[model samples]
Target chain A: MKSVVVNNISKRYGSKKAVTTALRGISFEVDKGELFGIIGPDGAGKTSLFRILTTLLLAEEGTATVDGLDVVKAYKAIRQRVGYMPGRFSLYQDLTVKENLDFFATIFNTSVEENYDLIKDIYSQIEPFKDRKAGKLSGGMKQKLALSCALIHRPSVLFLDEPTTGVDAVSRKEFWEMLRKLKEQQITILVSTPYMDEASLCDKVALIQSGKILSIDTPEGVVRSFGKKIIAVKSSNMLNLLADLKKTELLEDAYPFGEYHHAVLKNESNEHELKNYLQQKGYPFEIKGTDPNIEDCFMALMKN
Target chain B: MRTLKFLLQKEFRQIFRDPSILRIIFIMPVIQLIVLPWAADYEIKNIKLAVIDHDRSDYSRSLTNKITASGYFILTDYTSSFEQTLGEIEHDKADIILEIPASFEKDLVKESESKLFMAVNAINGVKAGLGSSYLRSIIQDYNREVRTEWIQFPRFSPETSIEVTNSNWFNPSMNYKVFMVPGILVLLLTMVGSNLTAINIVKEKEIGTIEQINVTPVKKFHFILGKLIPFWVLGLLVFTIGFGIAWIVYGIYPAGSFLTIYLFAAVYLLAVLGLGLLISTYANNQQQAMLISFFLMMIFVLMGGLYTSIDSMPGWAQAITKANPVSYFIEVIRMVVLKGSGLADIKYQLLTILGFAVLLNGWAVVNYHKRS
Candidate 1:
């Protein structure tokens, strides 16, 4: 079953003098129990799409639905069935961890004791400091408490928007692990993130740019579609290396990636020709042919 | 119903947990209701009388004694120099000066009609008007005594001199504190209700928690009432504490039914809280909400007729007050407390307030949407 369906949705803001289009004809779907990701950088309309899906904002065009229910017509039912954690930490900062949890539970007509089993793993991490105000907590602890609150009602479809944006690497890893556990419980998850690395963790990822979806595929599928030969090169002069690589007519693109620069080659070029051209420049270098990663594919799709 | 109960519980816990709001809610009302009435008094007293007695006759002395003994004015300085008295007026030392002309006793004995020169400092208009009027009344009584002594009355003596007895019906002595205590009580309830309600909703918006709540199944009206009813209960609690403080400090007991006062207060508080919610819906943050609430409060309190009488206002201002929820409550509280006006007498005011309650709350609910 399609747990979520968004078709050609567009959203714009501001008046005629200056208009900002946050989402442009975006279309995607999340199957039952599948974890889907909308991956992009900031200002790439990730937040806008999440807001439209969660029913917090109206899309200028297109239609969306949760389960079999329409987003606009069945908003009340959709609210009960869906959990949305916005990009910003939207919890009551003045409320303590325990109070905030219980409050959300009670408002949903359940109590913390009843949902203790569902959120025990996440909530127990912060339960030791449950009396502390949420504002005073560290960023990672707040993320845990917020996720616990979002799950207290056991929403059928969870919408987590940039959940690990400010979290440290250790907590970010643990948070993705928690999502993996949630996925085993057969809950459909639609998560958006500006972090490209987190995209691989989702079953399927949609790379969006400037309110437009660049590509939608599995991480491997996106990488397979790069359609270019590439080589990772390291030179003694890393800064001057990119200019020299771009200066070569045999290369299509050369951009820095981590410790080395990944250089895309034209069809006629060979590794020996590239290496010999760089060595004649009086620089010590090493070159090895490599696989195209999602980042490379994203840059390729973004250019088009 | 259960959702609202949980919301109210959360709100009350937050209200109690914040020490700053606790001081504003519980402690501030008691101090204001007890202390504000004394400072807001309208009764004028302690007029400084500078008696420049140019005539050193027995009648002049008698007139001076009567003015001093009236308990309104104090004999500040009994100087004979007119220049000294003028210097006193300039220095703000004396408010009234009495100068009796030379041979004033002989003029009254021979000429039955005599004139007394009186110089009054009229800068503080209420003090000056009241002081002069009190002095004139005392002088007239002395004049009647002198005339009565010269010629005896026919049968009734001083009793039949066309005695114009004045009776103050509601407030026997026309106590300014009695009139003011009720008015200030209305003001205290309104300030607490409207401000807390406005800031409560806007604080949620500022903290971005309103979006979280909006995504819930909570209805708009339920959300509004859940946020507002806690303040409503707190407003009534403040009213109760204020009523007790008024009785303890000022010894003022509402002459009418307590039910009537609470009845009007309940409706009036709903209307004011409704207005606050409407403002919160339009305001984007707590600072904007505070500014808007204060803007409405200044207009409501000043024109609510707490210090100024509505009858003396211009036609347009009076018409505005008719739509003012604060003024309706202020008038009802005073009428119920000071005049013992019952529900039957104030039914019109109660109905107007009920109308405002429905209208403002309905508008607020309609304007509040989960989607921005």
Candidate 2:
């Protein structure tokens, strides 16, 4: 069953003469208990779409529903069913960790003990600092507490907007692990992030840019859609390798990978011919055939 | 109802934890109510008098004695000449110089009239005007005394005189502090109610906590009520402190029942607090919220019938007070306190203020959106 569905939703801001479109003809869905990721750069309409799903904002056109309830018509019911963690750390900074939890639980007409089992793994890590004001918590600890509060009410679908954006690598890894555990509990989770490496962790991922969805598929499916032979190459003059490759016009796109550069070839160009051209140019380099990653796929899609 | 309880608990905890609320509510009222009445006093006294008694007659000496006996004037100098008295005024030593001309008793008895000159320093107009008026009344009283003593023909005496006695009802002594105490109490309640709640919601918005709450199942009115109740209770507590200070320091006790004053205050707080909430809804940050709160408070305080009577205000200002919740409370508070007015006497003011409460709070609830 579809746990969340959005259909061609659009939104714009500012006055008549100066309106800027934030989202345009966006449509997607998340199945029951499926961990879905909306991957994009900043200003990709991720926050706008999350707000629409959480019933905190209304779309200018089209419709959205959460758990079989319309986002606009059944907002009050949707609010009770879903939890939203905004792009910012939205907990009361002046409040302590324990107080923030208790407050969210009470508003949902539940007690912390009632749902202690759901958030025990996450909350226990921050339990020692329960008396500390949330404003004083570290970035990683704050995210943990925010997630604990978001889950305290046992929401069926959790909408987390950039939950791991500013977190450290270790905490980001632990947070994803927590989400996987949550998936085991049969909870549907929809998240948005700018981190390309994190995109592979979701059951399904949608590559969005400039308020439009470029593609939506599983991790391997998106990499497969790149559909061109690519090579990772590095040379002594690493800085000039990117500029020299682009001038050849023999490749579709060239981007700097960490230690090397990933280059995709055009349909007519062969790897043997490209190697001969590189040797003749006196640019001694090591090159090997490689599999495409999501970042490469997103760059390829954005070019067209 | 359960949501309100939880929200209110969090609000009260935050409020009490922050020491500023305690200072703004408790210490502020006690200091303002105790010291403001004494500072804002309009009763003019301590006038310095310079008497140039050229006549040196019995009547001139008696007039000077009468002026000093009134306690309004202090005999600062007995100048030998009017020029010396003018010098006294120029140095600010004397406020007025009373010149009893060298007529002896000859002009009043023979010519039936005598002109007395009074040279007054007009720099501080209110003091000078009051001093001159007091001197005139005393001299008139002395005229009546001399007339009755010298011309004691019963049938020929003045029969057309009309005596006008001022009772200055309720406050027969007409103490200005009695007038200011109640108005200052209303002002204290207004400042605490408007500024605090305005900053409360905007602070949440500034820190992004409002986003968390907006995404919840809490109703709009429930959120507003949660914000209002804690401050409402605090406003009442401060008001009680102000009332106690008024009595302890100024000896001003309400002649009317406490219930009547509370009735107006309860509704007045709703109106002012609702206004604060409405301002917070539109403000994007704490600085913007603070500015808007001050903008409204300046209007409310200046036009609230606190410093001046609404009747004496310009026609346009009087029209604006129809919608001003502050004016209604100021009027009702004074009525109940000074005149011992009953509920029936203040029914119109009470009903109008109740309407203002509903209108402003209703606007606040309606305008406060969970979305952009």
Candidate 3:
């Protein structure tokens, strides 16, 4: 059974004349107990889509349901069954860590004892500071507490909007580990992030940009969709290398990727000719064909 | 019911944990209740009198003595030059200048009537009005003394005056504190109940916690109740403290039973808190909530007839007071505290406030949407 089903969902902001289209015919589905991700940059309708699925916002067109319940009509029942952590820190700052968790538990008419086993892995990390106010916690600790609170009710479907946006690198890895552990408990998780690297951690990701989805597939499947050779090239002057590569009619696109510029060659451009042309320009460089990652695919999709 | 209990628990925890809220709850009552009543005394006194005694005669001296002895005028300056006394008025050394013209004794003895010129600095209109009236009454008393001394026994005076003896019932001493304490209590209740609940929900909105709560299974009715009950109880707690202060400090124990006051306060709190929640629904942040609350509270308190009389207000203002919930509570509190009015006497006001409670909370609940 599908945990979430969104069909042709569209939303617009502002008045009639100066309308900003935030979502355009957004449609997707999350299978039961699957870890789903809506991957995009900022203002790519990621938050708007999350809000629509969580029933906090209404779409101008189409329908969405969580756990087989209509987001609009059965919002009350959906609210009871789904846990949503908004993009921003939404817990009471003045409340202590344990108090925050207990408060959310009580709000859902549950007890901490009932859901302790489910959140023990995440909650145990910050359980030592249970008495400290939530606002005083470090960013990672705050995220852990928020996750614990979001999971306190043992929600059937969990929606986390940019859960790791401001977290440190280590904490972001640990948060993903926590999500992977949660997937084992049969709780379907729908998470959003602007970090392209986190896309592979999700069971499946929908690459979205400018209020539209470019593609929805597994990590490797998205890279496979690139379906073109990418030559990673680097020289002493990496700055001019990108500009030089883009100037060539032989390449589809070239962007800086760490120490090397990942250049996708046109179908007609031969790798040997490209290397020869660069050598004749008196620019000594190293070039090699490389595998595309999610970021590369995202960049390629965004270009199209 | 269980959800409401948890909600109240969280709200009260937040309230007690914040030092600023504690200060507002405790410190404000101490300052407003203890200091305001004494400072807001309306009984006009200490009129600075600059006397221009041109006659310098027995009667002028006697009039001056009587005016000074009346305890209303301070007799700031006594001089022969009217120009000098005008300087006294200009310099703010005196409030009223009493010029007794020359031949004052001779004219009064021969013609039995004489005119006296009194000039008052009209700035600070209340003081000027009250000071001049006080001086006028004292002069009239001096004239009565002069006539009684001059007339023989059993002789008919030329003028017959109708004497109006006044009786200030309920508050026989006309103590300003006694009248003010009850009104201040009502104001205290309003400030605590409305301002706290007004900012409570908006604080959640600003912190982004309201979105979390909205996504929960918590019903709108329960959420609003949870926000309201803690503050409502706190409002009544403040009221009790204010009432105790009124009794211990001002010696003002209400003539009516305490139950009547609480019963009215219970309904009054619901109305004001409902108003606060209604404002919270419209406001997106604490600043907006505070600004809107301040605006409505200003209108409510001013027109509620605390500082001024509703009857004295113009027709439009009086019409506003009729709609103002604060006015009803102020009127009800005064009735119960001063007049010993029972629940039956104030049932009309109680019902009107109940109507306000129903309307405002209903409108708030209707406007408060779980999704937008």
Ranking by DockQ: 3, 1, 2
lDDT of each structure? 0.89, 0.89, 0.91
Model 3: residues >4 Å from true position, as ranges?
A235-237, A271-287, B80-93, B153-161
Residue B62 lDDT (model 2) = 82
Give a tens-digit lDDT track for model 3, residues A272-303.
87898788778789999898888998998999
Q: After the best TM-score superposition of candidate 2, give how far the Cα of residue B300 lies from its true spot, in angstroms.
A: 1.8
Docking class for candidate 2: medium
Residue runs of model 1 more than 4 Å from their true location after superposition: A111-115, A229-256, A259-290, B45-163
Instruction: Give the TM-score of chain B in candidate 1.
Output: 0.91
- Candidate 2 Cα errors over 4 Å, as ranges: A233-241, A270-289, B44-160
Could you give candidate 1's per-residue lDDT for residues B165-208 as a string of tens digits? 89998899888888888888888888888888889899899888
User: Candidate 1 has what TM-score?
Assistant: 0.87
Model 3 lDDT vs. the true structure? 0.91
Model 3: TM-score, first chain = 0.98
* Candidate achieving the largest TM-score: 3
Give the clash total for candidate 3: 0
Q: Report the C-alpha lDDT of model 1 over A75-193, residue by residue, as the tens digit.
A: 88998988888878989888899989999888888889997887888998999999999989999999999999899999899999999998999999999999999998888999988
Residue B138 alpha-carbon offset, candidate 1, angstroms? 6.1
Fnat per model, in the order given? 0.87, 0.87, 1.00
Clashing pairs in 3: none
